[model samples]
Target: MDRPRRCVLLKFGELALKGRNRPRFVNALERNLRRMTADLGPIEVRHRGGVFIVSGDMPQEELAERCLGLPGVSVVQPALRCERDATAAADAAVELLRELPGHTFAVRATRRDKRFALRSIELARLLGDAVRVRLGLDVDLSNPDLELFVEVDHKELLVSVERLRGAGGLPVGTSGRALVLLSGGLDSPVAAYRMMKRGLRCDFVHFSGRPFTSPESIYKAYALVGRLDRFQGDSRLYVVTFGPAQRRLATAGAGRLQVLSQRRLMVRVAAALGERLDAGALVTGDSLGQVASQTLPNLAVVEEAAQLPLLRPLIDRDKSEIVDAARALGTYDISILPDEDCCQLFTSKPASTRGHPDDLRRIERTADIEELVEQLAESAELFHPTLEERAMVSAATPASRGPSLG
Candidate 1:
């Protein structure tokens, strides 16, 4: 047998059905798996029996944690499994279960290893019965305090009792890097998750309309990113102060174009930062024709501000879709937190549904938005990932040194 740390099995859902797209998704997942682990160490991925098995001497749990947005992967699990010889497999299960915290137990088996000659139910019962005798614990088949799960693959039978909740998306950094125009809004984070599911590495460039708004908003925004950063790599934040920029642009008679102008500036800031961050595009969590600002005309005006490609993963999506995604990605709770962001600052009464590029171009003629942008960017706060030593997230940075308030 190989060393104990030799292999970790990565099982995927949703990607299995697409016969042709499957390969591309697999390739993307592999690339992301590597990028997220660039700081970790070496690892190898092998494809067998429709599941990807990762082998390495590095931290399997850490690698698994970093793989929240890995494309094509539904879940990531680290475990040891072998041929389904009931007596032997049960013995291994018993040993592993003993290492966990609590003990009232049960074993669940999913038999796809036909050669084992036992139904999944029977296999589970046999293993459960064996563990009960070995560990001297009573079994509550309905729901034992501790569950030992046995998943039977074609070539191997995997045994694991505990599963960690993963970021539960595609691998981060697989699709390409994208600088998300992350407003501290409920929708944008969810949108970022949608894009990440396709394998995009995301870094946030948050725009703060400071002075007009308090730093508390930026704190809220970064707090939201902290939750997201758990799945993405290192959770880096680039804060851009839009206060002076917005004031200058607005004083120059940029009223109807205020929102559009602000968005353009944000796009420009994100583009510049994206280059520095090695990101490929800009992502916004806007739904199609939902808000007055999101109307086709308004969206076109705002999008023109960015030189790089713009990705609106949530553009065509609905509120239900956004909420569902938010809830599923685990950003829902924090997003609903009572923290205010820049968007709430200028809640325009009767906001614009149609914005003309001509108006934006006209505004560009007066106020030097770019110069203000430069000044703000220069004065911006920079942060780095609180690098950890172990594969598992033993600890994270304290909230004190985290991203500053708006």
Candidate 2:
């Protein structure tokens, strides 16, 4: 006889707290799940009460595994559906326990179908007796080696032995959007991930020093976004040519102020693009005092150029903490690859602490900030990696040995 097909059950965490906007967030989560799992095969996704049930030809375990990365999902269980009868529910619980390896077990059962004669406690006791008689396993409610979970809803009872933890947060796109200034470095990608965890769907804006510098940064940004795509589905990358703008800033001969001027221009350009994309904010990976351009007064001076909120997710984190998070997110290896960042080009001595707004104004006199931002926006190259491109990136070699620009 063929084994009964199983389905994965998903429960929402913070998303459940939403009052009137609950359906919107739930719909967003459903869309993301469908898009991420479309390649697995044909699947059926249904939401009942507060739980989502996914039934399809795809292996239930694999589906549960894939759902671990989805935000708004709190728990995943591979459950077998059975008729909502005490005997059938107990039999299904025994079948699940037979496959699981454990001598000490506990049955946590919930009876939602009021029409069923057995109460919650009665159903748990019945299931426990069945396990004890059929399999001879001792019950330890406090600390069990394995736990069999049963949920009786409407006309069916769902039974499972294993429950997996999910990535818990508000669904992406439930919050407003942001434009992330993604550099080919460890911090920016981590910043992007943090913002996504907060429910902000992010589009990337990368400034590369092509022609004047290697094309390594562009490829690195692509690889970085590819990893992030797993979380937010698809991402759009705006690559702006920054070499000409760097030269313009250097022409001012403001010495240490060149870095500050360059940052101001970058933020200005990012804000402009952010408005174009209708992003509510701009994100960066700036950590306090990590670099010469990130000083308190320097950050203040640079932020004056933008009209929108500049969100620095890593502002308070130390480099070590940021690196640890990067490694965990699987972007550390790619970010550590050799690449010439535009910010590192053409500058030797940068301001150690801060630069005065008076000195900045003096330097601003030499270059047309408006023209530079407009030029960057005009020459920007937009990249939206196809699903195939993302898959290729996932299977390809590490970025260090990966393909380079011709």
Candidate 3:
């Protein structure tokens, strides 16, 4: 006979506290899970109590990796389903424990279905003796080398020897959509990841220094979005040609305020794009004092250009923290790639650390700000990395299944 299908148990952490909006958040999480695991195979997702039970004939390792990228998921465990009986639960626990590498073990039994005869402690004691006798594994209740978790819910029982940590946060799409100002740098990608972790579904808008610079930045942006799409399943990137605007600012002699002027323009353009995409806000990688343009005064001046809310996820994080986050998100190597992004093309002296509103107004007068924003909005190129394309890319590259951030 064929073996029983492997199952994964998904637990929601903060989503359970959503009260009235719990259904909506749970639905969104279910939809995201379906999309993320579509390539795996035919699967079944059932909501029992507050837990999501996923069953399919796929590799648990791959499923766990995909689950960790999903927001709202706190834990994913490869589980075995059995009838709600003490002997069956003990058999399942012993079967799983036999495969795990551990001499000391513990059985944690949770009796969610109170109608069952035995309580949690009684069930644990009963299963513990059975496991110890069958597997000869010493019991370590305080700190076990391996833990076999058993959950009795209604008429079913699920048992697992290991539970993997998930990407804990609100489910993506539960918060809303935002357009991230994606740059070919470490910080922006990390910022985007942070927003995603907070349940924001992010679309990207990358400013490319094409024509005047190499296409390396554009490629880097593509790679970064590709990496991020692994989390969201689908992603859209809008590449806007920004060299003309930079040259225009240079020709108009913006002086020391060039960087600040460029930032304001980028914000305006991103705001325009955000409107078109119906994004709730604009996300950037600006950390306080990280760069000259990121100073408090310049940030304030630049904020005036955005019509919508501006979210800087990395505002207070230092460089080392940002780099570590980037590495964890798998974008550090790609971000470290040499590229002439729009921010690097212009040669200017030390930028003003405190850009005044009057200075911004004077700089705005040199260029038709409204016209430039409109032009960028009209001339941007959009790219959508579909699920099939992403799967193809993953299959072609053997390293796509490398260690997950979690």
Candidate 4:
């Protein structure tokens, strides 16, 4: 009549491959897990061999689900923990497996604690026999209808029947930080997500066509960042009103180079903001040849204005691939909503696919680029997409100090 205690088990993926720096990776993963689940009250993560046993007052499945989205975690299993005795383990396994649908099962046991009374094979046999006798199930080693795993640690044994896949990568904060040029579009959100999966924690900067356009784009960008915040907490979004700058570029008679010039100026503003925040790089959603401004030569022209490394995570991906990723990431619906993006403004002619950097420099000289960058950076409004202190995102900068068209 003994019932097993509920717990959660976590397994690593690439972190296990780190030979000498394994401890650092493991510690980071553990720390991230603890911080992610801190709202569930006091929780303890016990490292046993390659698995982490998480025990708390909350439901085991809930804990497992939360850990599934975290980076560096490969598998999450809602498990039952019992004393290190064959009878206890067998009872736990049977009780847990009763809810699962299967005619055949296999008990895979790992004895990390050598001091345990039974060997791994013996424990598996014992547990399998108990299931066969009590539950009337057959055993199939190679391809079983169900799988029951028993992990023997120094203090206890964990029995689980379900293994859930997790977000497999290095933990966030391990790769360093970057600023994402998040637009209210499908591709940029996916780009941010890809970078997050690669261990880069990101803040966001959005260019909005305010004073000349509606605030719809700002809402979409905020919502997109809010969705992405679930993967990495502490996300901030900076809004820079870019209508006036776009107008300046247009009136300067840089007709064919309008889009490229706007992109360059946007990067310049992002780079300036990134420098003040100590970010090492800037992330963009530019896929190669997706649009005129994203073409090879045009992209190079835009890159000329950035002070930091401009990372395009979606450079080689197709639009279909990017859309699929966005749908899977839960950002597609928000991104598809109607919005007036800054780039959509002031384009009277087709963008030049092969923009020369010298032409862009001449166009930029018509305006006080440094003063405009300073005003854009200083007047930028900040938003906390994930935290509780989030405020309403203002579309326009302060009237007294707003950057204007030259």
lDDT of each: 0.70, 0.83, 0.83, 0.84
Consecutive 10-residue window with the lowest summed lDDT within model 4 = 397-406
lDDT of 2 at 5: 53
Error of 2 at 318 (Å): 3.0
Report the lDDT tens digits of candidate 2 across residue range 211-285: 798777787788788878878877898998898888877887757777888888888899988889999999999
> Mind giving the per-residue lDDT tens digits that candidate 3 earns over 261-283?
88889989999989999999999
What stretches of model 2 exceed 4 Å from their correct place?
Answer: 1-4, 391-406
Q: Which digits, one per residue and each the tens of the lDDT, describe model 4 over residues 57-132? A: 9877678878888888889889898988899998898898888898999989987888888899999999999999
- Candidate 2 local distance difference test against the native: 0.83
* Residue-level error in angstroms, candidate 2, position 387: 3.9
TM-score, model 3 to reference: 0.92
**Top-lDDT structure, candidate number:** 4
TM-score of model 1 relative to the true fold? 0.67
